[model samples]
Target: MFPAEQTLQLRALDPEDNRIETSAGIFVVEGSAFDEGLEAVAIDSWGTSSCALDAYSAGDVADLGDGETFTLNADGTYIWQGDDDQISGRAQRFFFTATIPPDFTLSNYDQVLLDEKNSEGMAKAFFNTLTVVIPATIILILIAAFAAYALAWMKFPGRALLVATVVGLLVVPLQLALIPLLTFHVGAMELLTSVMGTVDEDSKLTSVNWFGNWFGMSEGEKIAGKGYFGAWLAHTGFGLPLAIYLLRHYMVGLPRDIIENASVDGATEFQIFTKIILPLSFPALASFAIFQFLWTWNDLLVALVFLIDSSGNTTVMTKQIVELLGTRGGDWEILATSAFVSIAVPLLVFFMMQKYLVRGLLAGSVK
Candidate 1:
């Protein structure tokens, strides 16, 4: 017996003998049938005041009995039976034949899963970018401010040439010197190791069991050979030329009268720069910072050249996004999400610094 929410159980008979048994209540059957074995049975309701049996057969079926009993001679059919003659319908069921193209397969589900994973990886990449951004910004601003003041106001031999040389370097594309620079970095690291009495026969920095403790490094972790420090140096080096050039121009453009007046009041160069020049050059410094922040934030080639293979330990956001795209191109959703995440930091930097960008630090320089 079967109710609306309950299922009916039925036993299968052999292919030749199709026997249907109906109890006193409604019965429902749902199952497939074999070619030489029992066929699928369908029983919606039976023996009720309003009962109907809709039978769907694949082939010509020999109804062995009336509403009470049904049989199939050859092919299989779905049969729905009802009592009290309230509803009765019979239909033939046919086997469906689908032709799949030779090249096509089910791939939508896999693509969706891959896209989700890529999106997560992209988020991690954004975090890495922040790690690079915050420290690099602070370092650049400090170094640039000091250098700018020295070149602009403080008199020294070769100061003009030094400023000109740094500006001239802006013409040299970074791609041209990438390899040479990396080689120099590697060699310098080795030299530092040798000077510190830590070089091994293979020229690698020897592990110092005690120094790690002093520096709070793990017992076996390599502290100085290559790592975050190396990356920071590379970023600072690449960022220095433009930073120095822009900042020098802005600082040099500060009011000469202000400096002369500060000097007349018995102010030292350090005091003048710290108290007068710095406060006045904030706009120029902020502008240069925005430029450097964006360039370094979106940098992929530099990261690849310097920090490749530093995946889990030191991989940046750019590298992470690139890897995700290469591995999961089919995942459009993930790609879009990753793209937006990567841009979010630069966007914030620009929006935050935009207010001060309009001021001209050179306003009172000439006068």
Candidate 2:
């Protein structure tokens, strides 16, 4: 349907049916569609020092060859990489129109794994899963390493009780702690904001809240005042039990003379732990890291409760896969391919570190 109001105009080109104009304005005269939409170039904004992205938004004129321009628009958010700093990102134009593809190949990968609106948004979700899994794995490992070293080598008050408690927690279901932990996480953030924040009334968040973007978890990034920080702590809490139990057993198995001789040389416990224990306990650390990484990577429950909001900015792969299954459940090809996309990373991770995994699993696995 050409514009009914405006007089139709066309170039002198012949066979106008397949020649959709790619330049200026989208125009369709009589029996053919010759139209132009928008064009956006994504020059990489990534700087050398950091992942400073050169982001661009697609122009609003985007539309399929529907003979109607400006009628289809969608939010196209794509996140590439994320560290404690800002995430690498890009935006695409998601235009929707009802039309058949010229041909159907293996496109389930596209349909199930892509799209800004209903598709799983696997690209962002993959990086988002990384954002949660990597940090959570690192945090839990470091904390557990310290706790394990102290428990194994140092004699402190309540040492036995602490070990017992960690062991006890290993049996506790993480489900039991989710609600309580989220409540506490939210409360603590609010308390901090109230105490040490410059409130920005327009956004209803402190202009500069805790850590103040030093770690890149600013107030604006929070959903219900919880985002990566909350998710990190949540994963850390659940993982600490197993992390400590495994590491402590492994640390205790370290040679007594090495630790005693290090202390005899007047080396501090911190030095011993860093220089001696860390190097020696690499396998145990790696094994726990693998387990922790896999747990957080595949976890939908913790991600939903602690990280993701209605905005879907912080969604992880597991949740995204669930959305795909829910929305495109009938499409078996899509479900199959989507399942592959979900496991690819974990499989790669497992294979890469599998040798250490075996050593971690067997080395003084229990006290």
Provide the overall lDDT of each model, using Cα atoms, as 2-decimal numbers: 0.60, 0.66
Model 2 C-alpha lDDT versus the unseen true structure: 0.66
Instruction: Please give, for residues 1-367, the per-residue lDDT of candidate 1 as tens digits.
Output: 1111112223333322332335664332323334334333333322211122223222323243344333332223334433423112332222321122233333433442355865455555666667776777779888978987898888889998998889888898888887888788888876655554455667654554454345454422332444555566778877888888888877776679989998999999889878998898888888877877888888878767766554454667877755655542434444555566667778887888887765643444555
Q: At residue 335, give the lDDT of candidate 2.
A: 58
Predicted structure with the largest lDDT when compared to the true one? 2
lDDT of 1 at 120: 59
TM-score of each: 0.61, 0.64
Off by over 4 Å in 1: 1-116, 195-220, 224-226, 326-333, 360-367
Residue 183 lDDT (model 2): 91
